[model samples]
Target: QAQIVELQKQLEEVTRARDGFQTELEQAQKSNTELTENNRGLTANIDKLSRAQHEMLQRARRADEALRVLEGEKEAADRAQGSANTKLATQEKQLKTFLEANEALESDLRKQMQRVALLERRKLEQEAEQSTIEAYYQARLDEMQAQYDRLLSEIDDSKRAAQQEVYRAFDDNAKIVPPSPGGGRSPPGKAR
Candidate 1:
């Protein structure tokens, strides 16, 4: 009976140890399943972060191209402004020169007007002097023509008086002389 009891106790201890090992195996299997699920979640998060980084790089490249285009436009605008400034200065200088030339022409015109007035005054004075000389010569010609007409009248009167006196002497001699048979007058100083 004593040997049988000792064997029975030994058997009970072996059975307990077997149950403890089975519990430990079940707990280890559960921990391994949890670790696998966490690893899959971490991989999905890493893929998302990589896609976001690629999108950010593409946006930065587009911004750089836009900045270069804007800088080129600004340089062209500056060159156009410089050309406009140069043209404005040239036009201003030309306007000033034209104004100066116009002023000089006005002064020359005034001088010519003064010369024309002086010449006109001199011509009027010469015409007045010529009129006076013509009037003096016309008066002298009228006096000479009146003296010639008086001399011609006196010569005609003297010739008519001498012819009347000769006719009277012939008549007186004819009365003093008598008619002869020849029917002619006697001599000029004697009676018939």
Candidate 2:
């Protein structure tokens, strides 16, 4: 009986171990099902990512082509700008030359005008001096003519006085003469 009891105890222990193993197996199967569902969702996400990557690649190619066209336009514009700058520099030099010439001409004109003014002043002074000389000579000539007229008048007065004195002397001598013989008798060579 004691041996039989020992054998029964061993069988019960084995039975408990088997039950524990069966529960462990069921839990492992449930965990596997969840892992499988997770894997399917991951695969669907991978498919979406692949489509997005293809679209992005196509857009990148088109962007590169547009960048090349814009670069070519920029090069043409730079060439045009260089030519315009050269022309502007040449025009500025010509303008500077023209301004210098104009200034020189203005300076020369001012000098010529000053010379003309000086000559005109000299001419006016000379004309005034000539007029003064002419007036002085005319006054001297008038004074000389007045003195000559007075001298001629004095000579005429002296000649008339001498003639009158001689007539008076002849009358006085006749009054003082003695009676001729026989009151009207003829003197020698007298007609009777």
Candidate 3:
């Protein structure tokens, strides 16, 4: 009978151990179900992060391309501005030279005008002097002609007076003057 009680106690202990093992198995299965759900959520988050990273890389590449295009445009604008500055400087120099040349030409023209005025004045003076000299010579020629005419008239009057005196002297003497040795003053039959 004591051996029978010991056997019954051993059987009861075995049944209790079996019941604890069954509880442990049930807890393990419940934990496994929760862990599976957590793993699925983690995987979804990883996929979302990877997609965001890819979009950021695409945006960065586009920004770099935009920066390169802007740099090229700036260089082109700078080169154009430099050329414009150089041309402006050249045009300014040319304008200054033209202005100086025009001033010099104006000065020369003024000098030429003054010289022409002086020459015209000299010509007028010479013409006036020539007129004066011609008038003086004409007056001298008129005085000389009047004096010559008077001297000729006086000589003619003296000749006429001398002829009258000789004729009177011959008449008073009352002598016949022979014209030549063969011709008497009157003919023989016609004595005067």
Candidate 4:
């Protein structure tokens, strides 16, 4: 009976050890399953990161290209501005020369106007002098014509008086003298 009790106690100890080993195996399997799930999640995250990095590289290349184009446009604008400045400077010089020439022309026009005015005044003075001379000469001619008419009338009257005196003398001589042999009287100064 003591051997039988010792065998029963040994059987109970064997059963407890088997239960402990079974519990340890179940815990190990649970840990392995959790590790596998974590690895799959990490792989998925790595794939997403690779895609994002590719997109960023393409964006960087495009940004570099846009910068190059902007730089070319800036150079073109600078050249155009330089050309415009040169044209403006040339136009300013031409304007200055035109203004100076216009001023000189105006001065010459003023001088010419003054000379014309002076000549007009001189011409007016000459006309007035000529009119005065004509009036004076016309008066002198009228006086001379009147004097000539009076002298001609006086000479005509003197000739008529002399002829009447000679006739009276002839009549007186005829009365005093006798008749001639031929019955004709002789002229006052002739002998028959």
Which one wins on lDDT? 3
lDDT of 1 by residue, 1-192 (tens): 343344445445444544454454445445445544544554454455445444544544454454455445545545777766565455445545545554554555455455545545554554555455445544544444444444344445545565676687777556565678657776678887
Give me the overall lDDT of model 4: 0.54
- The top-ranked prediction according to TM-score is 3
Residue-level error in angstroms, candidate 2, position 123: 0.8
**C-alpha lDDT score of every prediction, in listed order:** 0.51, 0.53, 0.55, 0.54
* lDDT of model number 3: 0.55
The TM-score ranking, best first, is 3, 2, 4, 1
- Give residue 144's lDDT in candidate 2 (0 to 100): 44
Worst 10 residues of 3 by lDDT: 1-10
Off by over 4 Å in 3: 1-82, 168-192
Please estimate how well model 1 matches the true structure, expressed as its whole-model Cα lDDT.
0.51
- If both were scored by lDDT, which would come out higher, candidate 2 or candidate 4? 4
Clash pairs of candidate 3? none
TM-score of each prediction: 0.36, 0.41, 0.43, 0.39
- For each candidate, how many residue pairs have backbone atoms clashing (under 3 Å)? 0, 0, 0, 0
lDDT of 2 by residue, 1-192 (tens): 443354455545555554555455455545445544554555555455455445545554554555455455545555777666665555455545545554554555455455545545554555565455445544544444444444445445555665676787776556667777878777768787
Q: Candidate 4: how large is its RMSD?
A: 74.0
**lDDT score for residue 113 of model 1:** 51
Off by over 4 Å in 1: 1-83, 158-192
Error of 1 at 59 (Å): 70
Mind giving the per-residue lDDT tens digits that candidate 4 earns over 1-192? Answer: 444345455545544554554454455445445544654554555455455545545554554555455455545655777666665555456545545555554565455456555545555565565455555555544554454454445545555666776787777556566677656867668887
